[model samples]
Target: MELTDNLKRVKKPDWLRVKLPTGKEYVKVRGIVSEHKLHTICESGNCPNMGECWGAGTATFMILGNICTRSCGFCAVATGKPKPADWDEPKRIAYSVKLMGVKHCVITSVDRDDLKDGGSIIWAETIKEIRAISPETKFECLIPDFAGKWENLQRIIDVKPDIVSHNIETVRRLTAQVRIQAKYDRSLEVLKRLDEADVKTKCGLMVGLGETEEEIYETINDLSNVKCDVLTIGQYLQPTPKHIPVAKFVHPDDFKKYREYALGKGFRFVESGPLVRSSYHAEKHIF
Candidate 1:
């Protein structure tokens, strides 16, 4: 009975249904991604907007490697021992962005805990290389916390990606169960440091993970206190049965309320909805 009730609660709602993308542009982008051996969180993370982004001829490139060190419950990215950081990744990513001719590009990566510098050196080089070839293009880097090493974090800060993002993933109450090894306060510190640098800082959190409304507002208050520039709130979908099950499907109306509240708290931009992810509608947030 308990299992049946749980299954009922986890079923996806109608609003969450989406058609898979198909078009010449998506196929073209897929070929480019495959040809370059580039990794994209859009596919690795199992983001619902991957198809939509590809259909428009853009993609969020993932570096470091496809394998992640952490085992976050809500993520679809594979986890295991990752390969050594590839030195040539920056040039390949830059050329791919140039070839696609996108006005803006978002870059993200899996957690690489094995690295000494936490892959910060490659991160800095990637941004620099991208600027060298596509001087006109903009960058949004959704980065890791570097295991609380502020110096490693600074490498990314010095490069000056248009926006720096690191998702808290969920409210404080669910952080341990959802993000596993990630620390709730530490994620806040990551955003706080970015905010202090006077760079536009952003972070995302997923809903429908059994957190209360008050918990959500409390997370918002914490972000506001840190003066985070942008906030993205999205519904949590179960990537697999072995992963954490969805608590419930949050309604669109609740997402609207979240948007209004976040904006009131002084967020310059907020993307709140069922399909929103860390990089969803990323091009608009650069403003």
Candidate 2:
């Protein structure tokens, strides 16, 4: 289905509207990101929270490269043969975090399937560099599954970021449809392994992807079984005509219900809403 077709059939709800990016802090963060040749999921994914996050002087940095190897139907990150990994990228991101004076930073990246370790080396180095340069700043690594390679995941666990998050993206039935190359059970295993390693583990899911309420509750139970510490639920907006169309616009009340359900299910923290993203209100998840 084309983007225009979805637009014609489904009207965006009023609650989905977001403020245009502005303010000195937003501009300064934008400039720093540009000046340092850094890429962010905020701009790459066209996140609705970009304005608010950047305005607060916090942004999630996308490392390794802007291009991805997987063509997940729900993602907006470009997919293709990615450029070679940048060995110096870790130091640069570390310096950028120090310069931004970010108290709590979020780091994520495009899938680098072409790499041997799926860019886990860069992931670990980046965290180490940031810790060395800005000892007081806490950070979270929103990582990829690395095709469920335990050794590659070990690289990240060794660095010991405050939190390690791998997004489930959608329900089990929709995993193949939304995250074309990703496996739902494998993602659960990744979170489980992180929890086993004593690293704080987190996972995110997007609603409005044709998933039923029962399926969502089942997903929460699966995550809880693995001892997932934090959870984020958000409405999915189609980025282009080529992407999957929104199945529905969930109401704010439903989001609140989900949040309460997750909290009662033993999640340490939960962020749920129409505009929520994986990294929205990310700083609070540090606990």
Candidate 3:
């Protein structure tokens, strides 16, 4: 599957349309995010479920800043030389988590390939501070691959989030075109290593990236081989015109099939739909 395929974009179906976020809870969440100078993937990645998630009083926080180093074609997060790592981010995130009083919090970050630790130190610190402030809270870290460095990955492993997630993004054939700087097998390795260490490992898949159903099944099997416990499969909406074009708008029935297939492959939990993302209904996965 080519990245742009001559920029021939597919029409977005009605299933992809979403309402804007409103309500008191949504405003409160937004205010807290702004007050602390925090960033969220919900905003940076142009997630369709932001209104639903934030209006319900939860959000997937992005750490290590909004600026990203890797310029993945599918991502909406800005790519450039990121500002210097902020060591104090953990405290603010911890405070925010406590303020929200959420029992299950999902945390993710933009790729910080420019950093020596690839932002793993802050990842660990954020988790630690959250635990310190909100001991009862269950945590999930939707993380970068840390440039495939074992030691940096180990920092997140050491923190022992309730569930550790890294997205496979797209299948093998489309990986290079879609992910650019990411290697297909290396992502599997990251999940495998996390599962080996007894972490509840999870990964997300985006369909509609010109991948065949056979390829999707194959990717599910590969994740199963690594003993990944949770899986999410969703349609890939082109974040912007400049990003990769949507090759297809997968049907909801197909997403159901994908869920059943993943369940049969032994995933403890699966969320498959047009709107699913890595952090979609993340709290349920830990249960």
Best by lDDT: 2
Whole-model Cα lDDT of every candidate shown, in order: 0.91, 0.93, 0.92
TM-score of 3: 0.98
True-structure Cα RMSD, model 3: 1.0
For each candidate, what TM-score against the reference? 0.97, 0.97, 0.98
Give the per-residue lDDT of model 1 (tens digit) for 156-225.
9998899999999899978887888899999999999998898899999899888899999999999999
In candidate 2, what are the lDDT values of residues 1-287, reduced to their tens digit?
A: 43224444468989999999999999999999999999999999999999999999999999999999999988889999998899999999999999999999999999988988999999999999999999999988999999988899999998899999999999999898788889999999999999999999888999988789999999999999999999999999989877888879999999999999999999999999999998999899887
Point out where model 2 deviates above 4 Å: 1-8
**What tens digits encode model 3's per-residue C-alpha lDDT throughout 1-287?**
35686588677788888998999999999999999899999999999999999998999999999999888999999998888999999999999999999988899999988888999999999999999989999988999899899999999888889999999999999998889999999999999999889999999999998889999999999999999999999998888889988879999999999999999999999999999998999989985
Query: How high is the lDDT of residue 170 in model 2?
Result: 96
Arranged by lDDT with the best first, the candidates are 2, 3, 1
Worst 10 residues of 3 by lDDT: 1-10
How far does residue 152 in candidate 2 sit from its true spot (Å)? 0.2
Model 2: residue 44 alpha-carbon error in angstroms: 0.5
The model with the greater lDDT, 1 or 3, is 3
Query: Could you give me the TM-score of model 2 versus the true structure?
Result: 0.97
Best by TM-score: 3
Q: State the displacement of the C-alpha of residue 83, model 3, in Å, after optimal TM-score superposition.
A: 0.5
* By TM-score: ranked, best first: 3, 2, 1
List clashing residue pairs in candidate 3.
none
